[model samples]
Each structure stands twice: as structure tokens, then as C-alpha cells.
Target: MAAFPYYDTPAIDALNAQAVALLKLFAERGYVREEPAVLQPAEIFLDRSGEEIRRRTFTLMDPSGRELCLRPDLTIPICRQVVQEGRKFPARIAYNGLVFRHQPGEPHRATQFFQAGVELLGLEDRAAGETEILSLTIEALRVAGLKQFSLRIGDLALFGALVDALALPDGWRARLKRHFWRAGYVESLLYWLGHGDGKAKLPGTRAEIEALLDARADAPMAGRSREEIISRAMDRAVEAAALHLDPAVADAIAKLLDISGPAEGALISIRALLKTAGINLDPQLAAMDGRLATLKSLGVDPGQVQFTAHFGRNMEYYTGFVFELWARDKEGPVQIAGGGRYDSMMEMLGAKKPVSAIGCAIRTERVLAAKIAGGA
Candidate 1:
């Protein structure tokens, strides 16, 4: 018979040692190390996580019949810990633990995974916090023996601004943004913008017109016919036209769709796009730009890092920057580490104030696999 495999294998031992060393480094940096409970109240996760996440959580009843769930992610539970303990702001806490999510028949995607990260609370300096989190992530990846990975960053705030600039109806705006990252929806969006194949129908336009017409017909004018109301609605449509595309709005959308090149070039293009759109460079945005400049000054090659405008992870809670590290040549499940900013999460978890939080989880098995494949 074949020899039984042991968790004490040299490869696994090496990865664990690296993880412990990184954890110690984080602790030395004034990050309060805490081991979070592996299980938590199911409701806590269900309330904050998006619909897709809620479905995947591993849940069961406790001894007293209280619903319990194996932690799906650390951020939410950390928020819960803060709320329960009434922790003060500007608090820096770090945790290293395994989280469980239910996945049947998915061997590579295990139900159990390790998460190591920090949450910085009450930091009014959003940009500083974002920069620190990203820096920490890069450092962790380097320590974990991942050297040839590029950071793909994006801002939901910029995307939100583009949406507001469009002046699209509320329903349409919501629908379009919901489908923005979806594959095969680019043509649909272009169609909605009156540029591509006009296949999909916009709902409720006729109903809205009919409602306006009926109200006008019932107004002070006595015995007004329905035809008059329809005529008035048609006049309104002709005057307003079909949501004329503002040049600025067009430029913003174009920028988001234009995902190419390395980080520096992307930033230059983004700045130009914003300038053409007449968007005043807000201090928050400026600070982010400055942070990138600092990173470049530190000898980090901007050309080596890709900034994808719409490259968001599947997670919905990421409010600011999001990134994934991948091997330069590997194709399947290439992620080595990934995380982003989640400012509003504490509030979502019933905390008194917003927590300025960012984190990255390194997939140890994947890291080891890559290292071995690279003959490291």
C-alpha cells in the first residue's frame, strides 16, 4: 500500500512557518492579535453578506437550538467582536484563523480556508488606511514567496460618480450597474446607451407616460380625452429626447471600459478622462493619487502592476480598492491573495462608527504549488 500522507510534510511545514512568521510581524507592528471564534451567529453573516454569499455559508443549530454558522469571512466577525467589546476607534486588530464555507463536490475549493488580516477602526484618514492595507498585502505576498504578481485595483466611488453623471433614470441606472461586471453585458449596455444592438427592452417607460398622462387629463381641464394626455406625454418625450448622452458622462463610462496596461499608464489615462469630464479632483482622490506616487518613489514599478477599472472580485462588500495576485503564467485559480477596503462593514454589523478596514488572505496551498512549479 502507498504510504499515508502526513500534514507534517516539509512543504506544508514551510508554508505554516511562513504564515506564523508573518503573523508575528503583524503583531510586532502593534496589531492586537486575536484568535476569532470559528463559529458565530448565522444571522450576523446573513445580514451583511450579499445574497450569493449568504447561500454558501455553513450553518447549523447549536446545543440550545440557536442558529450558528461556521464563519464565512473574518471581517464580519471582527466587527461583531468590536461591537460586543465596545472597542474604541483607531484600533488596530489582527487575526489569523480558519474560516469555513459550505461547498459540496468542490475539491479544489475547500469548505475550510485560512484567513489572516487586520482591521483598522476609527481612522478618519481613508486614503492613508487604504495605502497601508495595500502595502501590507504586498509585503505579505512577498514574504509568502510570491514575487511575480501584479495588483489590479479599482474604485467603486469612481464608478458611482460615473453613474450619477449619466442622469439615467433610477431603475435603469441600478439595472445597468448591477450587470456592469457581468460577461456578455457590454453589448447590452452599449445598446442601452443607444450605440449597439437594440435588443433588450427598457421597462416601465410606457407605464410612466400613461400615469403622467392620466394625472394631467384629470386636472382642472374638464372632460379632457385620453388622446390629449397621450399627446402631452409624446410632447414631453420629444422635448426631453431619449436621455441625451452628456460628453462628460460618455468620457467617464469610456474610462471604466478602458481597462489596459500597467498601473501608471492607467492612472494617467484616468486623470485625463476626469479632466475632460470637468470633475474637480477631490482631496480623497488626490490623496489616492499621491499614495500611488509614493509607492512609485519607493521603487515599486508601476508598469508591473495592472489597474483594471472594472475588475472587482465576486464579493459585494468591498467598497473601495480590490485586488487579486496571480502567477504570470498560470491560468486556473491563479489567486494567491486578495482583499480590499470595507469601510461601511462595521456599521452594517451594528458598530457605532464606520471601521476603516482592509485585509488579504493568502492561499497557502496555492502559494506552495506555485513555488514548487517555479522550481523555487
Candidate 2:
């Protein structure tokens, strides 16, 4: 597909047919369809999403002086809509629409595409929420006539558990979790934890951060008060001075990121690794085991699943149980669908309290491509 798709009438009809089938499937599962505006506040995406999305987003100043952007992805917008509409919980919302992003230097990559999926909000049972979404995505692909896909699963909760086990300072914990999705940054952070000499200096001087803390009554700067920023800076300085990560703990984290294999085997490997490090993650491990068992009960073959300890997708909002479904194409395995649980996202997007949520999005065009390649 080109940067902009221009399909003939027949092609458009065929594409709509696939999308309609998906919407129907979602409705049958009780996901009420929603249509969020294509134009959304730019800061919402920039602030909440990961760096990968922030750079690709297309932004412009509206006549009213607010920065607006075409929706980069439906999940954020849908969640924002839920918060805006004061929707009650246990909400099952479905959406199918075009999202826009700028694909610099990749003209062949479509800048606009159709993503259809459902979000289960306020589902107290996280494992149940995940299983429902995963089963629905797989079934949707099969319903669209593509089969033979493999599952790659990961859980950010595992890493969070590890961080908590280490008893790291609050500031350090926040920084580590925020930057977890970056490719090489985690290694740098681990290195800093072990060797403070290699640590990058804080951006501003002690006096500067303190002065911001002392001052009062300033207009909202980028949605935060002067005090919040100053307090965070001060916390980092105090935290950095307070602790040093044991080299052994750093080694355990590195080893964790290196793990990848069959699902059960990988979990066993992780359990062993944490045990040796004097950290117990049995609760997290058991939760994972329960999820896999639930998936199998729903007909997802365990043999076809692989677990990578470090595979958090580009989206930083995912707090747990992430996964990707890959289908073979002319080149190799292509990712046709992916999603995960982001329980904190609703609160971040303005919910009164934390809302348990999980969802997945299917790239409709890629589904079609994989179908054609498999001669289905």
C-alpha cells in the first residue's frame, strides 16, 4: 500500500466487507461500536504514548490556537472518549476507523490505515479480559480467511515485579519503567545502577531545581506545576545518592531480558533466574501460568506460543500481558495484530480511578496481504 490508499469501487467494497464482518463479530460479543473524532488534542498523544508514536504524529495549530493532530491510534482516543463521556465501567467498546501517521523515508508504507478492535474497560479480572481479547483477535483473523499464525507473548508486569523485588528508590523505579520500551536505554540504566560514575548528569543544577521548588504561582507549564517538576528533580538527586544496585542484581536483569523460548520453558527459566537472585516472583509467574492455561482452554494451542521476557511492544502504555500475532508472508513473518493490558491508561487519560482494561487492534490491510500470500 502507498502512503495514501486509493482503491477502486470493487476493492473498497471488498475491504468494507471484511471490516463489517469484524464489527459484526465484536457486536455479537457485546462491544458497542463507537466513533471518535479523527481530530484529537495533540498533547494527549505526545504526553501519554511512547516516543515512537510522538515522532510520527502529524500536528498543526488550529484557528483557535490549540494544537490538534489526526488520531495516531484508536486506543488512546477511545479511552479519552470514555473519560470525556463519563462512561460507566465494565464498558465494552468497539471501533473501526482510519488512523494517520507520517512515515518518513518509507513512501511505500501507508500513512493512513484501518484498525478495528475492542476495548474492555473496568474488567476486574485481568486474565479474563486478556483471554477474551486474544481469542477474539485470533478468531477475527481466521474469520477473514487467514490462518497459521504464531503468538509471541510478553508481560511488562514481570519486569515491574523484578524492579519491586530489587527495592530500588522510587525515582529510579519511575525512570526505569518509563524508559523500558526504548531499545538500548534499559542497559544504560542498569549500568548506571551498578556504576554511578557512568551515570549521565542531571539536566539542570541543584540550585535551579530548588529555585523552581521555592517559587509559587506560575501558570500551568505543560500541564504540570512548577512544584511537581522540582520535586521530581529533587527526588532523583536524593535517590541517586541513596543507593547503588548490586552487580548481581544487575546481572539478573540482563539475563532476564535475554530469555526467549517455548512458553512454559521460558517461565521456568525466569522462575529459576529470580530464585537465584534471591527475589521471589512466584505470584507473577503463577499469574502468567494461569493466563496460558486460560488461553489453552479457549483453544489457543500452547505449542504455537513463544514467550520473550523483554518483548514490550513500542507502546509504552502497556502495563502487562502483551502479545503479537505473526503470519508468514513473501518476505517472512509479518505482524498482523498486537495489543495488551494497560490498566493505568484510563487514570492517565483522566479517569477518577484506575480502570482495568485490555484490547487488541487488527491491521486489516496486513490481514489481507497475508491472506493473499498464503493463497487463502
Candidate 3:
């Protein structure tokens, strides 16, 4: 009967009540609640939010020839606010609002959904911040009455560090980091890096370019003269020639990326892989162990989490820890909430300096849907 797909009175009331409950929990944790404007500048989302968000953001033009967009997600806008206000260290912020995004498929998925959560900012300890964010997410979902859920955790820093520890030069390291999240590319990369052309004349591996720095001697050509074409070839070579990688190294890293299991044994497997490669993930591992202890102290079961060495979350902004909470429905498991640590993103968002930030956002719509399907 309505012109557009939207919640009727009862549904709207339910969503509002859920938002209120989550906000109340955040407030109790010392997070000051703030309501941000819905319309935001387009440039921020376009430049920093990654391609997935950029494509779906609803953009518009103002009378004064300025570009604006409906807030695709709340994290960036909040960070933008923190930057603009010049907020002091360790800001605890709680916000609840409707965010607009274009969901092309999945009829049940909300195009515009109500999200409520908190962001812990400017913390000095990365492990402590990640643990707190994850613990709070678990508590909030429990409060919302979701009975069964899984938390998949990942760390880009750990994965990146392992790749760095490999013998690959900086160019190869950059390539691997950039494509780590994409499907299928990783496996192909490993084999190609280790075994390429019969001649195995990949640019970085080629005798002509010595360790990617040798290109400095090449004359500038066309539009990209200052080692332009050479630099481009080096990058392309890095992309194409996994040919130079030793079979042992490629297999070792591949095995590392494949590590995934319950937190109980996941840590053991990860440690073994790192040790085998002579990779020193001591600092990151120690931080991870600290996070587990904290989670246990907070009454969360470490066994419930699944850790993946290669699993980077959807958002490109995350640089350290990442997590998602999913509850099973008639269809399958659906993600109801997610968050991660982006220690450097705030500075990119206009902050004078980088801040250690971790936060979780709950999809009130998904939470409710999953509950109904689970007979809650």
C-alpha cells in the first residue's frame, strides 16, 4: 500500500526501541551520545571509504555547486566530526541513526537501516581497544536477544607482517597487501610469485631490474619518464612475476593464509606457521594473547571466536583487528554487526594526528530479522 518499501508503525516502533536499548548500553559505558547530520560531503566517502561504499553512496549537488551524499555508513562521518571539533584524546562516542546505501539484491536487506554503536577513540593500547570493542559488540547483541552467533576475527597487521617477513622486496610486499582481501587472486598470486614463465623473467625477478631499485638508471619515457615506464613495468612485473618466489616461501605463506579455526587452536596453528617461516610476530601475537585474556576476564568465551590469518574485513580502512558477529537464520548465518581497529584512518579523515580507534555498529534491522527467524 505504500509507495516505497519501509517499515509500518509496529516495525518502526520495534526498531526505535532496539536503537534506544543499544544507545542506553553505550551511555552506561561513558560514551556521550551525539546525533550527526544525515547529509555529508561526497568527497570524503569517495576518497577514503573504499570502492564498495563509493559505488553505493547516494550523491547529490547543492545550489551552490557543492557535492553531498547521504551518509553511507556512520563511522567516517563521526571521525570527520572528531576531526572538525578537534576532540581531545580517548573520545567515547555513541551514535544511532539511519544510514543510506544501495543494496541491489536480497529483497529482505534494508536499503536504509538503523545502526547503533560506539566508537572508542585515541586509545594508546591497540589490543585493549580491540578487545573492548569486540566485547561490547557481544554484549550488545546478547542484549538484543540473539541466541546463537559466530564472531570471525582477523588482523591485517599480523598478515601484512608475515608477508613482510618473507623475502619479497617492497614492491612485492605492496602488491600482496593490496590484493590480500580479494578472492582467488591470493592463490594465483602465490603460485605465480613462486613459479612464473619457464624463463621466469618476471620484472622484479628479471636480471635487468635488481630488487626493483635498479629501475632508477632507466631513462624517463613518455608521460612517466622519471623511471615512469620502468616503474610501471616494475609494478606490473611485481604483479605478474611471483615467479621468483622460492617454492618454500610461497607454500609457507599460503599455508599461513589458510589457517582458520576456533580461537582455542587457531592461535596455535598461527604460531606454528609463523615460527616455521622464522617470522617474528611476537609483538602482534603478544597483543593477541593479551586481547584473549581480556576477553576471558570480561566473561566471553575465547573458544567461540574464529580467527583467520588472511581474513581482512570488507572495509579497507581497517589496519589491525577486524570482527563480525553473525546469527543463523532459516536462510543461513547473517552478519548483524561488525567493527575493527583503524589506528591511522582518523588522521586521513582530517585529524591533526592519527588515533587508535575501534568501534562496532549494530544493524538493528538485521538483528530484528534474525531474531524473528530464530523464534525470538
Candidate 4:
């Protein structure tokens, strides 16, 4: 496949047929089909979706001089629409459309791709919400003729629970949680905490601070008075300089990140690891168990699920229960679909209060290819 895919008549017909089937299934399941705009405000994605989206987004400036972007994914746009419309709770929304991303060098990846999925907004039942989306996603793929794949699951809430149990300083906790999604960064942070001096220095040294103060004497940055900005920098400098993580605490985080395997065994290992570290996450662990049970009840085989401790799906908005479904193409294993619970995103998108949101989308191209390869 090229970055800009060229579909012939047969390919086009197949995709159209698959899309119709998906839309029909969604309607039967009580989802109202929604068509969010193809272009969205760039800032919303850049600020909330994390660095991966920031890098891939195709940004443009409209004639009005406002920055806009081709939506990199459908979930954010759909959620934003729901918030803007003041929709009632537990909104069952479904959509299928072409989403754009810049995949410059990867010919196998499309710059513009057809995606179809559902978003369940304002649903407070966490376990039930996750089950509904995941099971529906599986059914959608099956209807599109997919046969073999495995589910990879992770929970940011679980990781947050572990961090809270460690009893670290506020600054250290904030730093760890903020960079949780970046690859290799957490390991580097752990190493720095263990080896470096306890004190951390801000970028503004005494001379630098004086220069900045002189330069900004008549100006305020982002509504912050010069005095206020300098004061905050100084305060954070003091707090950061005093921040340090205990070697035991760092070790605990390392051990947790190291645990990953079959889902049930991973849960057992996490429990044992927490016990040895003298940290109790019974409530959190029980919640995870409940989700797994719910998944089983919804027809997902426990044997097909894998769990990893540090797998926060690169989207900063996801607050818990992230997942990806993978299938092998001729090259290797490729992710065909993914989504998770992003409970905090609604408030970030201007909702009056937090709204529970979960969704998953199939890469229609990949799923279609997989279906064809299986001679379905």
C-alpha cells in the first residue's frame, strides 16, 4: 500500500461493502451514526492527544488565520462534538470516515485511511463501558471478516495506583506521571533518581533569571504578571531542588514495569510484586479483575488477552484501560485496532464536568486486507 492509497474498482467495492455492514451493525446495536468534521482545531489535538498525535498531525492555516488540522483520529472529534452539543449522558455514537495523518516514510501506512468505530460517552460504569466497546469492536471486525487476533490490554489507573502507594513527594509524583507514556523515558528517570544528587536545578539560574526579569519588565506572558512568573519559577526551583525518590521506591516501579505476560498470570504477578513492596492495591487490582470477568462474560476469551504494566497507549488523554488488537500481516504483527478509557478528556474539552468516554476504531484497510488474506 502507498502512503496515499489508490483503490481500484474491486478494492473500492470491497471497502464500501465492509463499511455498510459495519454501519448496519452499529445501528442495530443502538448507536446513532455521527459524522464529525474532517478538519478540527489543531490545538485541541496537540494539547490533549499526546506527542504521537502532535508529530503525525497535518496542520494548515485557514484563510481566517486560525490553525486547523485534518483529524488524526475520529475519537477526539466525536467527543468534542458531543461536548459542544450538550448531549445527554451515555451517548451511543458511531461514525465512519477518512482520517488524515502524516506517514511520510511508511509506504505500508496510509496518510489518509478509512476508520469506523463507536464512542460511548458519559457512561459511568467503567467495567461495563470497557466491555461494551471492546466486545462491539470485536464483533465489528468479525463482521468485516477478520478471524485471528489477540487483545493487548493495559491500565493507566493501575499505574497511577502504584505511584500513589509509593508515597513520593508531590514534584516527583507529578514528573513520573507526566512522562509515563514516553518510551524509555521512565527508565531513564529511574536511573537519574537513583544516581544523581537529590537536588534538581531549574533552567533559570540566578544570572539567567535576572536577564529574563530585565527582558520581561514591561511584558506579561500568557496573562501571568512578571512578578508572578518569576515567583512560580523560584518556588518550583526550591521544590524541585528538594525532590528525591527513595531507592526502594524506584526499584518498586522498575519491578512493576517488568511484569508482563498472559493476562491472568500478569495479574497474579502484580499482586505478588505489590505485596513484596509493602504496597496494597487491592481495590485497584479487584477493579481490573472485574473488567476481565466482564470481558469474559462478553465472549472474549481470557487466553487471548495479554497485559503489560507500563503500556499506556501513547495517548495522554486515556485515564485507564488502554488496549490494542493485533494481527499478523505478511511483514509481521500489525495493530488492527485500539482504544481505551479517556475519562478526563471531556472536561479537558470544555465539558462542565468529567464524562466517561471509551471507543475503538478499526483500520479498515488492514482489517480488509486481513480478511482477504484469510480468503473470507
Candidate 5:
């Protein structure tokens, strides 16, 4: 039998050294470094993450028959620690570890990968917290010898605001937001609204019921009862089919759909669109505006940084201000570091109250690869 290959590569060792140095710098800045366990309960992920993530988790049963999973990400488990240990507010926690995910037909997507990140808990001021997180991420990249990267920032709260302002029905709003990433579905909505497809349809069985009742006025009560049952089922089916959206709301969403540009310009256009629709902007969003102004004052040009209005990472636990750092020259899947505010996760993990939080994870391999390519 052939033996499995065992090799120690210099590139891997250098990447590890770079990661350790970065973590040490974070620790010197008073961040608590943790080595989290490799295995965790499967329920922790399924309960907090979205369906797509849940499906991708690596799950198995233990010898004691409890279902367990390899840790897919470190944030949730760290939050769980805060809950179980009853940690205090404003905790600055950092972690470096390996995570696992099953990817079929995508061999390049490693089943196991390393992650390093920090979570700031119990900071209620979203704007201040967001700015700090962003700054820390930029510094981390620089310390790791990375330059020439652009940050793409976004706000999911803005998307929520658009949904609420348009007065879309609960179900349709949910469906639309859920599928907002799909261009075809969004276009279909526009087409439907333009063609007057918002009219509600009456079920066919209701007409049959009226006709039968008229023709057999003296029919037995049991036969009438049978028709009523069939009619009720048909009514439910009709209600289900009438899930089309309101035309005005559709128009509002269509306007929102086109909102993407440089940060300042996009904000101006969005505010105008909301005002024209008679919807007031949320005061909390003003904080984000203020932070953006601060960044501008600090010489980070809005034109250089792409600000997407409806942008979101795949994580559902993120509550605000998600961002991804991408190297300028990298083309495919160019995320070296990413994180966002996840204030509610600790409470969901059974903490006494909401612990405000923000975090970012650097894919160490990608960071080193970019650095080498840049001749660092």
C-alpha cells in the first residue's frame, strides 16, 4: 500500500508566522486571544445561521449519541462563551483557529481553512463601533504587509428601510428581500408591475358554488356542505396565488434597485428617493452619515471606496455595516478580510441582554498570497 504524502512547505510556514505576528500585535492592543475548540454542537450553527450555511455545515454524531459538528466559524462559539461564562460588557475578544465546511464539486474551496478575528462586545454606539472595526481591519492588513486594497461597505438597515417605506405586504417584502441578490427575479417583479399584474384573482370554485346553489335550490344539506368544503380549499389556493405586489410599492422598489455609486452620491440619491416617496429617513442612519463624513475628513476618498446600498455578506447574524476588503488587482472572489456588527448574537446564545459587537476575520492564506504577489 502507498503511504499518504507528508510534506512541510516553506510558504505554509511563512503564512503561519505572518498570522502569529498579526495576532500578537492585536494582543498588545488589549485584545483577548482565545484558542477555541475544533468541535461544537451542531445546533449552535443551525439556530443562528441562514439555511444555506446550515446546509453546508459538517455534522456528525458523537459516541454519546449527541449530534455535533466541526466548527464552521468562530464567532458563534465565542458568543456562546460569553453567555456560558457570563462575561461583562465591552469585551474585546480575538481568536485564531481552523474551520470546516463541505463543498461538493468545488475542490479549490478547502474543506478546512484557518480564520483569525476579533469581536468587540457591548458597544451600543453603532457608528463608533463600525469605525473602530474598519480601522482595526485596515491596520491588521497593513501590519500583515498588505497594501493596495479597497473596502466595500454596505448597510442592510437601508434595505430594511426601503422595504418598510414602500408599504409592501409582509410576505412579498420578505420574498423580495430574500431574493434581492438574484437579478432575474428583481427584473421579473418590474415587468409584472408594469403589466398591471397586481390585480387579485377570484377562485374558479366560488363561481361553480353560486351556479350550483342557484340551479339546485332544494338540494340536500350534505351536498351543500361538500361544496362549501371544496369552495374553502379553492379560496385558500386563490389567496396563495394572489401574492403579487402593489404597483406603487413596486415602483418604489424599482427606484431603490438603481441605487449604487460612490458613497456620498449614493447617499444623496437614496435620501432624495425616500423623500419623494414621502418616507422619512431613520435618525439612526444619520450616525452612519456622520461616520462617512469623518472618514472623508481623514482623507479616505469616497470615490475610491465603493459603497453599495443593498450589499450584504452571506451571514444572516450580521445586524449592521458589513464590509469586505479586497486587493485592487485580484479578480476572482477577492475577499481577504470581512466582518460586521452582530450585536444580537450573544443574547441569542443566552446572554442576559444584547451585547453590542463587531468583528472581522482575515483569511491568512489569502493575505500572504496577496502580499507575495505584491512583492512585499
Candidate 6:
């Protein structure tokens, strides 16, 4: 088999052309080109990129026993560069590169592909920042000859605010956040909350958990010693209560997730949910409105954008505002581009302080495939 994919003349040319055009857009907007190393520390991804990406990552060990992997995505490696180099804030950078992924038994899945996009770092004005990133992505698609696409937007920060307002137990907050993006999982979680056997859904009574920690008091796990585990469990005793979800709060969350349509209509539904929950989310609502206004000012029709509460795309680092652009096809809608804000990623990559950032990428292969199919 070939070391890498072999593309025919037309497809190769198309990829090259799309990359150049997309990079030009970024360049004109002050984003300098950046290319991170192809091989990176595997743990960086395994620890931060979420289980979906982790499972598909192509990992290996070097001769010296250093764990390494081919880059699964450009965003993390680029963020790693920014933190390591102490790059100045408000930096605009772009990259056109290949990312690798492999599945054990899925031969037909894409193993590698060309991706081109930009990341805007340290822009604190979120409304303007989101608008800039979304607009740039749309323009890049336009340059790639894409004409019709649906923009689906979601805000994790908004969802987080609602969860906080609900006053869920600390342990349950983590569990719910973990499943926030999975529509089915979230629905089931809400069900468990409204109708679970009291105390049975917990990891065990506080004392039982502590006893296990004490018994394994010498074994180490994932870097934590048994003593450390016991101490941690002791700290978590208050949080590990039975799964008790208030029926009203569960209904509110379900309603929020179900609010999907034009931007304005979604906002209306969100406000209703907040009112029913007796929570004042003025600041978050204002931020969402600001983003919508920013999008409108960028020439996108607010009516065309669909906003939803549970729209995370499985990228673990996306701290707020995720979106995907889809084009209609004979089979259904196919995503051509997607990305979002990941303000905490730099910290995850070892930064000493918080860093603000947002970015998106276009799949050159997918764009070309759509073009050839005459569907997008």
C-alpha cells in the first residue's frame, strides 16, 4: 500500500486551488501562515481532545519509548505552539495541512485528508470575534465554490449557565456536562434524574467509596496513589448523592434542547425556558443576542441560522459557541466546515494563564467531493 493517499490529477489540483484560495482570505485579514509539527505527544491529544477523537487517533511509540502520534487535527498542535512560544495575544494564524486518523475495522472511513483554516487568538470581544470567525469560514467556502449551506450554531457557555442556574449537585454537573452534546444521552440523563431509584444511581454510599479507596490504599491509578484516591473520595462524599433530578428542572432542560429553528425563534424559546426555571440569565441571553446581531451585521440572514442548546460537536475543548455549515445533498445535509471557541485549550496545553481563542477549518476533500458530486 502507498505510504500516503494518491490523488488523481484533477482532485490534486482542486485541493491545491482550494487551499491557496482559503489561505489568501486569511492572509488578507492579517492571519500569518503556521505549520505545527506532524508528530506530537500522544498524551496531549488523549487527555484533551475527547474520547471520539482519542479513539480514532493514530498513536505510536518511538524508538526511545517516547509516545507520539501523527497529528489528528491542526487546532491542538497550533495552540500548543502558541503556548510554548509565549506568542503575543491577538495573533491571527492560518494553516493548510493533512491530519491522520485510523479505525481498526472501518476500512472505508477516511484515514487522512487536507484541511485549511484559521485561528484567531486573544480577541476578547466575543461578539466581534465570533462574527469574524464565522464570516471568514463562510467566505472560504464561497471561494471553494460552495453556494448553499445551513449554519447550525450552539453555545456551550449558554448551556453551562442554565445548568448552573439549575443548582445541580457538583458531581451531577460534571456528569451532565459530559453528556451535554449527546442528544440521546442527555434525554436519558434527564429521565434518570426525574425517575431514578433514590441513592441507587450513585457510585455507592459515601462510606463505601471511601472504603474501596482505603482498601486499594497502595495501588496507583492513572498517576494517583491510593491515599490520594481516598482523600479525593472523602472530598467528594457530599457530591456523590443519589441521582435526584427535579422534574421541573429536567423539563426545562428538555425544552431548551428542543428549541431549534431560526435564530430569533430559538431565542424566544430559550427565554421561555429560563422564565419557567425562575432563573435570570440576562447576561448569557445578551451574549447570545450579541452573537446573532454580529452575524446579521456580517451579511448572513439571521433567519437562516439555526440555534440549539445541545449542539456540541464532540470536541472536548470547545468552551463555547460551536457551529457547522451543511449543504444539501441527495442523501442528506453534508457538513463542509465547523469549529468554535476553545478559550481554555491553551491552559490545557500547559499555559500559565487563560487564553482566548476561536477558529474553524474546511475539509478540502469534502468540498471537492461535494463539487464533483454537483451537490453543494
Q: Give the winner by TM-score.
A: 4
List model 3 lDDT by residue over 1-376, tens digit each. Answer: 1213578899989888887888888888888998778999999888877777887888999999999999998888888889888988899999888888876564455567778888999989766677778778888887788766777887888877877877777977888877775766876777766766343544563446644445555644455554555567677766554437776767777887788988768888878866776678898888777766766786766777788777763567888887787776667777889888877779898777678898989887778889888825
What is the per-residue lDDT of model 5 for residues 119-165, given as tens digits with 9 covering 90 to 100? 88887776777787777777888888886676677877666666665
Worst 10 residues of 4 by lDDT: 195-204
Query: Residue 184 in candidate 2 has what lDDT?
Result: 77
Better of 3 and 4 by lDDT: 4
- Cα lDDT of all candidates, in order? 0.67, 0.85, 0.78, 0.82, 0.73, 0.81
Pairs that collide in candidate 3 are 192-242, 193-242, 193-243, 194-242, 220-225, 221-225
What global local distance difference test value does model 5 have? 0.73
User: What lDDT score is found at residue 12 in candidate 5?
Assistant: 66
| Candidate 6 or 5, higher TM-score | 6
Clashes found in each candidate (C-alpha, N, C closer than 3 A): 0, 0, 6, 0, 0, 0
lDDT of 1 by residue, 104-162 (tens): 55544566766677777677887777777777767766777666665566666566555
lDDT of 4 by residue, 1-376 (tens): 6787899999999899999999999999999998978888999899998987889999999999999999999888888888988989989988889999997566567799998998999878877888888889888888988878888888999878777766568667777788888777887777666555434445446566668778767665888766777778777776665556677667777888878888999999888777767888898888778878876886777998999888874789989888888886666677889888889889998999888889888888888776666624
TM value for model 1 = 0.74
Candidate 2 differs from the real structure by a C-alpha RMSD in angstroms, to one decimal, of: 4.9
**Each candidate: RMSD to true structure?**
7.4, 4.9, 5.1, 3.6, 6.7, 3.9
Candidate 2 lDDT trough over 10 residues, lowest sum:
197-206
Q: What is the lDDT of candidate 6?
A: 0.81
Stretches off by above 4 angstroms in model 6 are 1-5, 103-106, 169-175, 178-196, 200-245, 328-332
Model 1, position 293, has a per-residue lDDT of: 77
TM-score of 6: 0.84
Give the candidate order by descending TM-score. 4, 2, 6, 3, 5, 1
Q: What TM-score would each prediction reach against the true structure? A: 0.74, 0.87, 0.84, 0.87, 0.79, 0.84
Instruction: List model 2 lDDT by residue over 204-260, tens digit each.
Output: 566866665557445456787666777777776776766788877787888888899
- Which structure is stronger by TM-score: 2 or 6? 2
What local lDDT does model 4 show for residue 96? 87
